[model samples]
Target: MFLEVKNIVKSFHNEAVVRDLNFSLDAHKTLSILGKSGCGKTTMLKIVAGLENADAGTISLGGKNIDNVKPGKRNVVYLYQEDLLFPHLNIFENIAFGLRIKKFPEKEIVEKVNAMVESLELNGQETKMPHQLSGGQRQRVSFGRAIITSPSLLLLDEPFGSLDAGTRQRMQEFFKSLTAKYQITSLFVTHDLKEAILMGDEIAFMQSGRLKVYKDKTDFINDPVTGVQNEIGFWENLIPGKVERETLRK
Candidate 1:
C-alpha cells in the first residue's frame, strides 16, 4: 500500500464525523469515494492530507508514519471544489506557485511549468489570468498547480461540482488522462454517482462517517447502497422498453 489509513476517527464538538475509517490505496491509482454532503468524505480527505488532526488511528504514506506530520510536510495536496487559483497570477504562474514555494531553481521551475502547461493543454494561454479562462481551463490550471509538485497523494473534493454538465464531462475525461500521465495517486471524493464510477480504479461508498470499499467495480455496482442499480432503474423507467432492449441485447 502506498497510503494507509487505519482506525481513523475524527469529531467536532463531541460529535463523531469519521468513525474508525480504514482504507489503503496503492501507488499511482485513484480511489473514488461516492458520498453525499456531510457524509465525512471531506473530513477524511482533510485528515489524510494532515489539514485536520485525527482523534485516533494512524496514517502512513509510502511506508512512513505521517500521523504527526504537518500539512505542508505531508506531501499531500488537498484540492477544493473551487479552483482556488491565485487571481493575481497568470496560468503559468499559478501552476508554478508550488515550485516557487519550494524554491526550486528558476530554470527548473520554467521547465516544469512549461511541461505542465502543455500537459494541461493550455499552450498559449499561459499568460492569461484565471478570470480570463473558462471554468474548465481554470480547473485545469488548478490541477496543474497541484500536480506539478508531484505530491505523494492528491485529495480532490468534488472538483468538478461547479461546472456545467458539458464542461464537467469534459473535465472528467481530461482529469482521467491527466492522472494517467502524471501517475497520480489520488482520493477523489464526489457526490455524483456516474463521476465516481468513471473516475475510480477502486471504488468506495461513504455513509454516516463510515466507509465501505468495494473489492471491485462489479461489487460496487452490485451493492444497492451505492445506488448504481437505482440510477439504471431511473433511466429505464424514463424510457419505455429500455430494460427489455438491454435484456434482448444480452
Candidate 2:
C-alpha cells in the first residue's frame, strides 16, 4: 500500500463521525468511496490530507508515518466540488502556482504548465481568466493545477457533482484519462455508484462514517453487504441494459 489509514477516528462537537475507519490505497491506483452526504467522507479526506486531525489512528504515506506532518508538507492535494480556481490568475498561472511557490525555475514551470494544459485540453484557454471558463473548463483548470504539481496522493470529494450531466460525464472520463496518464493514486469520494465503479480499482461503501471496503471490483459489485446489488439494480433501471455490462467490465 502506498497510503495506509488505520484505526482512523474523528468526531465533531462530541458526535462521532468516522468510527474506527480503516483503508489503504496502492500506488498509481484509485479507491473510490460511495456514501451519501454527511457520512463523514469529507472529514476522512481532510484527515488524510493533514487539514484535520483524527481523534485516533495513524496515516502513513510511502511507508513513512505522516501523522505529524503539516498540511503543506504532506504531499497531498484535495480537490473539492467547487473548482476554486484563483479569480485573478489566468489558467496557466493557476496551474503554475504550486511550482512558483516552490521556486521552481521559470523554464521548468513553463514546460510543466504547458504540458499539463495540453493534457487537460486547456491549451488555447491558457490565457483566459477562471471567470471566463465554463464550469467544466474551470474544473479542468483546477485539475491541471493539482495534477501539475504531481502530488503523491490526490483526494477528490465529488469534484464532478456540480456540473451538468453531460459535462459531468466528460469530466469523469477526463479524470480517468488523466489519472491513468499521470499514474496518480487517489481516493475519490462520491455518492454515485456508477461513478464509484467507473473510477475505483477497488471500492468502499461508507455508511454513517463506517466503511466496508471490498477486495476488488467484482467483490465490490457482488457483495450484498455494501448494498451494491441495489445500486446495480438502480443503474439497470436507469440505463436499461448497458450499465450492467459496463459495470462488470469495470
Candidate 3:
C-alpha cells in the first residue's frame, strides 16, 4: 500500500470528528471521499497530511510509519478550500518554492516547474501575481505548486469548492488528465458526487467519520443502503435519470 490509515480517531473538545477509520491506497490511483458538510471529510484528509494528529491510530506511507512525521517531512501536500499561494511570489516562484526549500538544483527546478505550469495550463501566467489572476487560474497555480514537488500522496481539500460551476467542471476534467500525467496517488475530499465518480478509480463514501469503500460504478450506485440502493441523482445532467422510490405493496 502506498498509504495506509488505520483505526484513526480525532476529537475537538469533547466531540469526536473522526471515528475509528481504516483505508489504504495503492500507487497511481485516485480515491475520492464523498459526504455532506461537517462530516469530517476535511478532518480525515488533514490527519493523513499530518497537519492534525489523530488521538489514536497510525498512518503509513510506503511501508514506513508516519504517525509522528511532521507535515513537511511526510511529503504530503495539501490544497485546501483557499489557495495558499504567496502574494509576494509570481506564479513560477510560487510553484518553485518547494524545490527551493529542498535545495534542488536551479536547472532541475526550472525544468520541472515549467513542465508543470504548462501541464496545468498556466503557461503565460507564470509572471503574474496571485491577485492578478482569476479564481480558476489561481486554483491552477495552487495545483501546480502541490504537484511540482512530486509528493508521495496528494491531498485536495475542496480545492474547487468555491469556483463557478462551469470553471469547476472544466478543472475537474483537467485534473483527471493531470493526475495521470504526474502518476501521483491522490486522495480527494469533495461534496460533488459527479466529480468523485469522474476522477476516482475507486470511490469511498464517508459519513460521521466512518469510511465505506465501493467496488465500482455499478456497486457505488446500486449497493444496498439500508434496504435500497443509494441512488444519487446529482448526475442527471450526464445520465438523465430520476430517483424513484419503490416500496413493496402491502
Candidate 4:
C-alpha cells in the first residue's frame, strides 16, 4: 500500500462526520470515491491532505506515518472544484509556481514548466492569463500546476463539478490521460456516479461518514446502496428492454 488510512474519525460540534475510515491505495493508481453532498468526502480528503485534523486514526504515505505532518510538508496536493490558479500569473507561471516555491534552479524550472505546458496542450498560450482560458483549459493548467511538483498524493474534490456537461466530459478524459502520464496517485471525490466509474481504477462509496470499498466494478454495480441499480432501472424504464438489448449485443 502506498497510502494507508486507518481508524480515521472526525467530528464537529460533537457530530461525527467520519467514522473509523480505513482504506489503502497503491501508488500510481487513482481511487474514485463516490458520495453525495455532506457525506464526509471533502472532510476525508482534507484529513488525508493534512488540512483538517482527525480526532483519531493514522495516515501513512509511502511507508511513513504522516499523522502529524504539516499540510505543506506532507508532500500532498489538494485540488478543489475551482481551478484555483493565480489570477496574476500567466499560464506558464501558474504551472511553475510550485517549482518556484521549492526554489528549483532557474534552468530546471524553465525546462519543467515548458514541458508541462506542452503536455497540457497550452504551448502557445503560455503568456495568457487564467481569465483568458476556457474553463477546461484553465482546469488543465491547474492540474499541470499541481502535478509538476510530483506530489506523493493528490486529493481531488469534485474537480469538474463547475464545468458544463460537454466541458466536464472532456476534462474527465483529459484527467485520465494526465494522471496516467504522470503516474499520479490520487483520491478523486465526486458525487457523479458515471464520473466515479469512469475515473477510478478502484471504486468506493461513502455514506453517512462511513465508506465501503468495492472489490471491483462488478461488486460496486451490484450493490444496491450505491444507486447504480436505481440508475439502470431508470434508464430501463425510460426505454423498455433497451438495457437488456445492449447487454445482449455485448
Q: What is the C-alpha RMSD of each candidate to the true structure, in Å?
A: 2.1, 2.0, 4.7, 1.5
Q: What is the C-alpha local distance difference test score of candidate 4?
A: 0.94
List the candidates ranked by TM-score, beginning with the highest.
4, 1, 2, 3
Locate the minimum summed-lDDT window of 10 residues in model 4.
Answer: 241-250
Identify the superior model by TM-score, candidate 2 or candidate 3: 2
lDDT of 1 by residue, 130-182 (tens): 99999999999999999999999999999999999999999999999999999
Which portions of model 3 show Cα errors greater than 4 Å?
Answer: 224-250
Better of 3 and 4 by lDDT: 4
- Cα error, residue 204 of model 1, in Å, equals 0.2
Error of 1 at 29 (Å): 0.5
The candidate, 1 or 2, that scores higher on lDDT is: 1
Candidate 1: which stretches are off by over 4 Å? Answer: 240-250
lDDT of each residue in 1-250, candidate 3, tens digit only: 8888899999999899999989999999999888889989989998998888899999999999999999989999988978888999999999999999999999999999999888987888889899999888888889889888899999998889999999999888888888998898999888876677677888888888788888765666565541224333433443554443221110
Better of 1 and 4 by TM-score: 4
**With candidate 3 superimposed using the best TM-score fit, by how many Å does residue 3's alpha carbon deviate from the native?**
1.0
TM-scores for all candidates: the values are 0.96, 0.93, 0.89, 0.97
Candidate lDDT scores, in order, read 0.93, 0.91, 0.84, 0.94
